[model samples]
Target: MASRFVDTHRDISYTKDVVRLHSHAFYELLYCCSGNLQYLLGVDRYQLRRGDVVIIPPGISHRPLFLEQLAEPYERYVLWFSQEFLDQVQVFCSDLDFRGGYRLLRTAGTPWESLGNLFAQGCREAERGAPGWQGHVCGNTMQLLVELHRACGKGEMPAPMVEQHELLDDLVQYVEVHLAEKITLEDTARRFLVSQSTISQTFRQKMGISFYRFVTQRRLIAAKTEILAGRQLETLYETVGFSDYSTFYRAFRREYGISPSQYRKLQQTQTIPPEA
Candidate 1:
């Protein structure tokens, strides 16, 4: 059986656009090495600084928003852990709680140093893949989480940098609740008592994406989640707001580089191994 519990990588000069606002079936821990970006966690937005850490739980929609041109390439260490891996760590560290929505740790002084060291060590182990590397990475991850839980207990977490925009937040939440219906920008603008241009500019200026594109991305993410849950691909297009299977198929292929059926088969063949 595979002994790997976490997938880890470091991006030195990452400048790719994460167009899809999607969720995962596992945990995501991101340590910002150097970057200037705002992160959208659900409806909340955060301005990330160097040494900031963001922890996202499974099934929560998230993506980074690049409102302006980056003066420097974004650098960060990203770690992905299976739910089973975290569950095992939780068993021994019962005081650490993992049943939360998301956490943004803005650290300084000793806590920042410790977390950065852990992230670097984990990345190295993952890269080398030496003998017993899996165990080493697992230990490092547990320690990192434990440290984070302690930091939270000590009140090191900070509030989101950007104040919540009531209209935009409500509109995003509205889209999430009514995602199954045939949603249109005109209808959304009318419901929110705003002009179509207002809605369009809000999405473009604030979210770095168009309103229609945001809705479509959300729907595609929902469809992807349902497919992972073993839903019938043929029955999902309409349910997820796509007019037909062909449209859904084309969008899915365009966004994810594979057909829905192909994605399902790929997932099935590479299911993460359970904890021993």
Candidate 2:
């Protein structure tokens, strides 16, 4: 395995349509500088505020839920590190919980500003690429992790949960269960005993997208995940709810800017075999 693999960057504005629910093969840490959004982490949702930090482990699906347009540009700092790098860090601090599922740290009364500064410093180091910048970025990351551990130890501030609309939550779960099947808004409405208009309006108001669009995004995400896992692309569309090859090919390329075969080859080249 490589000695270290880390990437850091800051996003100033929001792209509501392009931001789809997805998972990574590495750990992700996000600090909300400013945002009006709900975050979908696994099965739970969180209403994010300034100074809030979110940590997610590999293979856990997540995305920002844009319920409404932001008055200000949604700003955030994101850091991604491979598990190999985290394993090295854990040698010094084994008590830290990086694999205990997703964490939402509310920075109320905590040294959140300092934590945010660490994120900024890491981003700068990554972007400048000066001599010894990797070590500096790693050091900042370690200190940030240690500070977060200490903050969790305080146990004074608890993570606040978002009050999700029960119907919307059920709708999402239903879609997940039926992702491989042909799902329609009318079918969902009839199943839930509500009018089709209600279902359409609910998804538009709560998810910031039409019901069909959300389903398409989810299916495409699933197909991408399977591709990364080394699945054959020939019949992958049917398994992910795409009716035919051409439809899947067009949608996948449109959403990801590359063909599925191209994406598979790119990932294969970038992948590093684990040390024996």
Candidate 3:
């Protein structure tokens, strides 16, 4: 079995507000210790209350909006770990859908206290870095997952997650996979059986970007990866779904503030130093 060595834990108290649109390649669990914040996940905006737990899957775009002026810092504990770690825990609790997007586990009853303790323990173990700390952290994470499963089973998790979130997630993935193809908004809407307006609205609300801009930026990102890998710029445009060089050049420049050629030359120069 492949092993994963990535684990992160942070108990942060943000004095300033936060706003950004991004995604991760690992699972994230946020324990709201004390703070009222707005969390945007997919097309849904949630008012996160104290004692609320938010679970986010990999590659799902989400952002947290903090209060501009706060009497106290927005406090929360964030834990991020590889899916492999979640898989190991899932072996013991197989009914849970770990890959599901945006699971909200409300803190209530005994489970709430138990989860808080688990998060606290995990944070401590991670920070202490004592002998066998990794094992202790994993143990705490496993217990936390188990508790969340129990809460979901009892329907205490609520309907914070819905099919629309899952659908939007699938839509994003589909676009990524079909990036090289001449996939249009209409094509996506037709493929997913959703109206163009709904798709546009979801992108705006969740990603804070329009569908066209999102696709163009994603293509530029993909192109940058290939260019850094020494792929020729000649075919990079078509390979990454751009219809023409002029269009690709404009989009790349607009997104990166640098033309593709300039970007590639910069990457090459960084890798190859001048002769002494």
Candidate 4:
């Protein structure tokens, strides 16, 4: 398997207006530098305070909720790496649950300093752009995982609990069935006979994402599948419930790092493997 790494430091101000529930094919480690942030995983919301580190695995839907418009910048360090990186480290530690789902960690003592230094070093190596920097970053990333596991052993942080609710399941199914239609939080709340706050609270508490984000993400996923299946991009925006092409274009690019047309071309050129 191949390995890759990408790291960035963002001093973000203003709110992320759209609720874009998205995921990647790789793991993400988010280290909050400062400010209060709400981290959404699935439908559950975790209040991320400064120095909090969240470990998110591949295929797990999540997003950072910048609900309130900030007076000052909200700083964070985000690192993404391929699954192979975690696999290589797993051979040495059998108890670590790197691939299970996601982890919310708070550093303690030695592991705290260790994880911080490793992340800082990884960022530096990434910025330096020297020869063999990839190797250096990978090594540090592995260590960061190890330090994270060590902290877990010491009970530095408690694992976030995920509870099941029957209403949430129905809500998800309802959204999926009505993907092509215009829906709002107020409408959903009214249909379910719950208040807007109840809908938002339950979604954030159980699914780790906002109701709005979940709907948009589902629509985008449908849009991508239709695009890859040879559907015309110009016709998809309206069908996907996006009112305008520009808004759809921006959201699509933000989620996939490419325009719908570019994504279509890339998918078309790739060789699909035979099924077993």
Instruction: Order the candidates by TM-score, highest first.
Output: 1, 2, 4, 3
Best by lDDT: 2
lDDT string for model 4 (1-276, tens) is: 123444433335455443356655556787776766566665466777667788877556666666554444567676776655667777887676677668787653334744666777888887897999888888787778778887877875655444344677678777867878999998999999989998888777655578887788777866866676677888888887888888888988876677888766654544111100
Once superposed on the true structure, which residue ranges of model 2 sit more than 4 Å away at CA?
1-4, 14-18, 91-100, 111-113, 149-156, 244-246, 271-276
The TM-score measured for candidate 3 stands at 0.60
- Candidate 3 stretches with Cα past 4 Å from truth are 1-6, 13-17, 67-71, 108-110, 157-276
**Candidate 2 vs candidate 3, TM-score winner:** 2
Question: lDDT order of candidates, best first?
Answer: 2, 1, 3, 4
Local lDDT at 18 for model 4: 39
> What pairs collide in candidate 2?
none
lDDT of 3 at 42: 47
Badly placed stretches (over 4 Å) of model 4 are: 1-19, 108-114, 158-187, 195-213, 219-276
User: If scored against the real structure, what TM-score would every candidate get?
Assistant: 0.84, 0.82, 0.60, 0.63
> What is the lDDT, from 0 to 100, of the residue 267 in candidate 2?
56
lDDT of 1: 0.78
Worst 10 residues of 4 by lDDT: 267-276
Winner by TM-score between candidate 2 and candidate 1: 1
lDDT of 1 by residue, 199-266 (tens): 99988877778998889888887887789788899998988899999999999888777788877776
